[model samples]
Target: MEIRKSRMADLPEILKLYEEARAFMQETGNGTQWGTSYPPVEQVETDIREEKSYVCEEDGRLAGVFYFSEGPDPDYAEIYEGSWMGSGDYDVMHRVAAPGRVKGAGSFCIRWCAEHSRRDLRIDTHRNNLPMQHVLEKNGFTRCGIIYLANGEERLAFEFLPKDI
Candidate 1:
């Protein structure tokens, strides 16, 4: 699969992927991560318009979407009772969605961000998202701790730093 910057025209497909992700989360008993209101369509649209979003394609079909931004995320700035790995500059990922095609799309996105940014990448997931936690761990993302989301819900945070850069 190839990763490319998302365009305004990709919003519908990206929204569809988000819906699928929400359904999958519910089916897997991890609905708290994205519920029905997370990553509002307006925000997705904004991300697309601002060129902060990306989509993964396989054979010309969209497979996944994610947001890649540099610096500490505003939502993640004040982690309630936990601390991050460090206070250095970092790249943060948000709103990761997969079309349920390949099992490792999330990992691929994380790896891409880490390699392209050439810096520590941080991500957060709902506490009950075991699948995501497993993927992060398998891909060398160490669990830093818990942090509150923009909506004020606590989530487990993880970070992956490249060994050489």
Candidate 2:
């Protein structure tokens, strides 16, 4: 699989992938994480416009999508119960979703982000998202702590440092 910035042309397919991922999460007992309509269309469009959206392609087709960017991410500023693994500049990965048909696609996206960022990386997931927690662990992301979104919803935080490689 290959990873690249998303194009406007990929919108329809990318939205479908997110839908499938939402269903997959529901099936895996993680429905509340995304609720419904998480990562709304407008947000996705904004991500694309800002060049922060990316897609993973397999056989020339989009297999997964995510939002990644350099951060001083405000949402990650205050961690509780634990602390980030490293300080200074880091990149963040968010809204990672795949159709679940392609094995390793999610892991690939996470590792690709880490490899390309060349800096410490941070990510978070709903506490109930066991599959994502497993994938994160598989990709070398250490459980950091908890973070609260702007709305005050808590999420489990994880981080991967360059030296972890």
Best by TM-score: 2
Instruction: Report the lDDT tens digits of candidate 1 across residue range 1-165.
Output: 789999998888888899988988999989777889778989998999888999998888888999998876887776655577756888888888874777678778877887887577888888888888887888888888778766678888888776732
Determine the backbone clash count of candidate 1: 0
Predicted model with the maximum lDDT? 2
TM-score of each: 0.92, 0.98
For model 1, give the RMSD to the true fold: 1.7
Task: Show how many residue pairs clash in every candidate, following the order shown.
Answer: 0, 0
lDDT of candidate 2 at residue 66, scale 0 to 100 = 98
lDDT at position 117, candidate 1: 78
